[model samples]
Target: MRRRNRSTDRWRLADDAGSAAIEFIFAGLILLVPVVYLVVALGQIQGQALGVEAGARHIARTVAAASGTADADARADAVLDTVVEEYGLDRSRVELSIACAETAASCPAAGATLTVTVRTAVSLPLVPPVLGLDRLAVVPVEASAVQKVSRFWRDG
Candidate 1:
């Protein structure tokens, strides 16, 4: 066989045409996919957080506006149901708690503070349930709101 020209061999080795574009595309994908997934997860969590906050506020207001304790409890439950539906949250994963600040013996007295807490779990998109890691794939969001009973309000 004839000997290859050293200059042509060197030129072939130095040829880098189209390599930069390919490298850039690979690097971009490596950096972009995780960033996009993170943004989507955060957005979903934020929406659920906002929904929980709004639901707490609605529950507190509804409870405070009720004419009686029984009415308040019923109305609060109804509002919670509506919020669960509106937010598209799994009812089994959502929890609501109502308490009277500084008093646990009875219903809130006039001018007493009523606190409503809403909690829910938001599952991350594209995450599959892993053995012993199911809870890690979900984010928990909670919100609380307080409303004071009107001074003229009478307990039922």
Candidate 2:
């Protein structure tokens, strides 16, 4: 009987079989961390924008309430402060510009336009409170609102 070539026919696990694929899965998460971070960061930016726009709309209403002429710039600034203070946003991050146009029926000018801007540095979410390495997203966001200054009065 021929002797079995046990040494030549032995089966052994190779280190390379599907090892690369397993490694890829782990590495993929490392690469994906940044992308996930960016997605979350964007949500914070959107929140900031919405907050500013809401603040602007409220300011317009305030202007309409005053019987006297409203200092558009001052009003805009004040509104920003009120809204951002609670959210830890800096007033300086916001920009306020107003235009006054003569109206047909004693309107508070044509309208008051307010723009609020927040750079990533200022508006980064407090939840993370640190920089992320995954997706390097550092961008500013802006929100704007224009309100028609109608006859000023609040009878209720």
Task: Name the best candidate (by TM-score).
Answer: 1
Clashing pairs in 2: 34-134, 34-135
Residues 1-156, candidate 1, lDDT per residue (tens digit)? 899899998888789878999999999999999999999999989888988999999989988888878888899889888888887777899998888886746666677898989999998898767674666888899999999976666677
lDDT of 2: 0.56
User: Tens digits of per-residue lDDT for model 2 on 36-123?
Assistant: 8778878776677676667666766666544445464456567667888855555666655444444334335434332233232334
lDDT of 2 at 62: 61
Whole-model lDDT per candidate = 0.86, 0.56
- The count of backbone overlaps in candidate 1 is 0
Off by over 4 Å in 2: 1-25, 70-78, 103-138, 152-156
Clash totals, every prediction: 0, 2
